[model samples]
Target: MAHVVSKSEMRHVSVEELRQMASDCRESIWAQAQAIGREPKIYLHWTAGHYGQFWDDYHVQIDEDGEIYVYGELDEILSHTWRRNTGAIGVTLLCGYQANTSDLGPEPPTAAQIEGMARAIEALADGLWLTICKEFVATHGECADNETNDWCHEDYGPRTTCERWDLEYLQTDESPAFNPWAEDGSRGGDVLRGKANWYHNQRG
Candidate 1:
């Protein structure tokens, strides 16, 4: 059984290092996005458990402390949710938040991973020349006609738990300060805008 790692257990990776990794790995996505003119308007987060128990499920795979493995480009429209994938750059942490609920274990993201995600988010946003905000980080997209009319998009989209309880979304002072060994299953009461927005402010 894979154990959920503590922050201290996670490997450390710098923003520059992670950025370089993504640049080399997902170069195709950036290139294709440019060629196709599909201006990325949103950033979507996910834990996105894999297919066939392998790690080939994500464009980027991030370990607890920001150690990341990048593959492919952003052009591949396949990802955690459906409609949200249309105009968004999808980010998935390998922390495994969306795994079977009964199999839930220590799979939340580490502090450094959260920080790294912040940097990555800002990096992608800059590369895409996007305006970062919760509204655009994700907003309701129209659902399919065949889906339940009982479902209202205003409060819905698939992968609602993509970024569950990750503290990178909280304001620094209000957020639980980083503790390398902390394991708290939070519900992201207020989206930290998440790491994406956090790192953006650093430049502001």
Candidate 2:
């Protein structure tokens, strides 16, 4: 069973308050796992660049044998990672999907909650001098078409294109100058590409 905490339950909490709540929640989770004779292993600390949107709720996946694996963003209020503190803010939704159902029910997070999260993320990014597109690209590698070669062949199969700028393009003169309004705007592409090339050549 998926457990979702209500927005109202967290609406009143400030960032500082939320941080405290996260600490409590983590402690409780650890205690419960220990009580049930399960060992806890956290694979990743809050990393920046991975946006915790789309899925509004945190989740614990339990296998057929009842082995549980927890996955989701740990609220920055509770975590001390650079990503959590200076780049990303966690927003949890209050509903869970059934194990087999790809479509989780309509337990959409409130507008206010979404807006609050956006504001928080913006503030964090501003503090760190990071933009949303840069963050996305950094976390997810080269946004190439999954079905074809890097040449972007569409006739072969479905093309997987990223919505943001492709930083890799800026590495060579083969890529055109960036235009923010263009369909393929290479926003920070040149800067990143140049930096990467310089560093690589320096090592050489």
Candidate 3:
């Protein structure tokens, strides 16, 4: 029988510690997923809360200061995304409260938070043998975009009803590029994936 991990075992950690934790738990997570006959995928999100806020729905969270909080095990299911919890590792950035289409609100995603999430992605992808692509790694907005992805159960996203547009427009210092896949190419899942890929190569 598999050892049961408590859902309440949330812990605060730094970015480096998060990478170490992912490495330490790699084999167990992979074995558990195989035991359950499921493929692991990563789903990124924003809490829509204050910078220091934390949520129990997501397995991992990165705060405005790049502090990481682990809420549950990688293979443990959490109610972060609608209809996509099973075999899904949910990672969220705590920011975007009171955000709108034209505004990112006062507590927008910070550079540290974005880089932290990218590093977390690199660690998790390395542990899970996942490809940093749309099929394996996606944002809540992408999952909500029914037109582009089959992950959505309803018509909602920045391109649709404009709901669940978490991480739609990231706070970046670079000039953004417009693309058909996202409202802006430099602010979508591609950016995170690109950063994660860069980290992977740099570290390798």
Candidate 4:
């Protein structure tokens, strides 16, 4: 089956506005999740563009200062991931332009962007009734790294495409230099999931 392209255009919204929108659509999203053949997943990404540069491919985008942007409905089938767009929601950080395998470029992801994305993920998880984990919420790099799996198609990983290293090395207190493979237990996706889980627990 051919992948359907997304018609979502990036739209800026205040944090409060985003929350309100999520609350308004929570029931519908949950219903969709409960339906058979529906498995909600969130995919993290980086725009590979300068800060504030928005892309239509992703459903949500986080900016350098932690601002959030919505491109389309959470239930919409977006063209963010290859072959994994069917039930995946795409969230991205607007950074990493001109990034290469050796370096994350002039506009590497910032602390604010990471935090913003985490909060967004938490809200989405709550709405979609999803648990924050590698299987449910994965980074683009992680998915690309799963090339051995049947879900992954084509070579689009750091070692292969060399540009799929979004959030591969994230800045953390233990590893401020953004070490690769999370040698210090601060892999980008792990950090985001940890934060999102904390947020979820706090709500209980």
lDDT scores for all predictions?
A: 0.44, 0.29, 0.75, 0.72
Model 1, residue 109: C-alpha shift (Å): 1.7
Highest TM-score, which number?
3
Could you list the CA RMSD of all candidates, in the order they appear?
9.2, 15.8, 5.1, 4.4
| Candidate 2 wrongly placed segments (more than 4 Å) | 1-91, 96-104, 134-204
Candidate with more favorable, higher lDDT: 2 or 3 = 3
- Name the better of 1 and 4 by lDDT: 4
| Residue 126, candidate 1: C-alpha displacement in angstroms | 0.8
- In candidate 3, what are the lDDT values of residues 1-204, reduced to their tens digit? 112234246687765676676667667666655665645668899988788777778888888988777986766767888876776789998898987666778998889898889989988887677778878788888777743335438757666777777877675654143232544447558788889999999987
**Clash total of candidate 4:** 0
Q: Work out how many backbone clashes candidate 1 has.
A: 5
When sorted by lDDT, best at the front, the candidate numbers are 3, 4, 1, 2
Residue-wise C-alpha lDDT for candidate 2, range 97-166, written one tens digit per residue: 2211122123322333323333333322332233333322121112222211122223211113333222
Please say which candidate is ahead in TM-score: 2 or 4: 4
Q: TM-score of predicted model 3? A: 0.82
- Highest-scoring model, lDDT: 3
Q: Candidate 1: deviation at residue 154, Å? A: 8.0
User: For residues 1-204, what per-residue lDDT tens digits would candidate 4 score against the true structure?
Assistant: 322223245567765566566666666655564463546678899877778666767888888998888987866777887767765688989888887655677888788888888888888776666778888888888788673234646667664665476777664563344444554557777788888888778888
